[model samples]
Target: MCVKCDNCGAEIGLDGVCKFCGTVLPPREPVAPPPVAPGWGTPPPRPVFSIPQPRVPVQQPVQAASPKSRWVAILLWLLLGYLGAHQFYAGKVGMGILYLFTFGLCGIGWVIDGVSLFAGSFRDRYGLPIRV
Candidate 1:
């Protein structure tokens, strides 16, 4: 009869041990022992398995604003800079409204605004760093 190796599950040579994992086996036959002798008792209990915790990766949020848009900024400056349109684009709503009501009355404020927008000193509504 044939026997399968317990270590690798391979078919073993009928006369010897398995070649793959070097597992030994006894030939099929009942052994007539010298008899007698029996002792010891139950085996000890096995330890329970302890599971390890998995690590999680951290994620960063992205910035939402661009630093400046020259064309749009210039348009606001030309058309509504008197109305503080440029200031509004730069997230300065309060100042924009001030200019809107004043109608560029001083003219000086609008000129400063044009320079601010061109220089990238402006920020978007979110107050985040502006991308080019």
Candidate 2:
């Protein structure tokens, strides 16, 4: 048997509640009970789904920075970058030699290395990202 809404003529459930608009239905009239067979047994209750509800969003792992190249650059600048020592440390042998011949040109290469260190743009020989 189905319940219905008088205002909208929509079908409701036994709860006297309409699923569509959640409107309450009028009370049902009492009816006579039907006869039952002697051997019939009651059915089990329906199962409930309490949860396994999703909560927080997942995040990705953070990657670490490499320091090999940056340190070499700094070291070269300190030891010989006044004459492009650090350029050689960064694997640029030609520039290092040029700076060496030029007496480090007022230490310009060393200064650039200092700036690169602060800017977090210097990388290692393996091409990994450098951490500041």
Total backbone collisions for each predicted model: 1, 6
In model 2, pairs of residues that clash are: 69-124, 76-86, 80-85, 81-85, 82-104, 83-104
The C-alpha stretches of model 2 lying farther than 4 A from their native spots are 1-67, 123-132
Q: TM-score for every candidate vs. truth?
A: 0.42, 0.38
Q: CA shift at 65, candidate 2, in angstroms?
A: 7.6
Worst 10 residues of 2 by lDDT: 123-132
Write down the lDDT of every candidate, Cα atoms only. 0.74, 0.67
Error of 1 at 100 (Å): 0.8
Q: How high a TM-score does candidate 2 get?
A: 0.38
Q: Against the correct fold, how does model 1 do in TM-score?
A: 0.42
After TM-score superposition, the amount by which residue 40's alpha carbon in candidate 2 deviates from its true location, in angstroms, is: 52
In candidate 2, clashing pairs total 6
- What are the per-residue Cα lDDT tens digits for candidate 1 across 32-77? 9564545545455799998998988887976566756767877878
Residue pairs in candidate 1 whose N, alpha carbon or C atoms collide under 3 angstroms: 67-130
lDDT of 2 by residue, 58-91 (tens): 8888767664556656666666667775666555
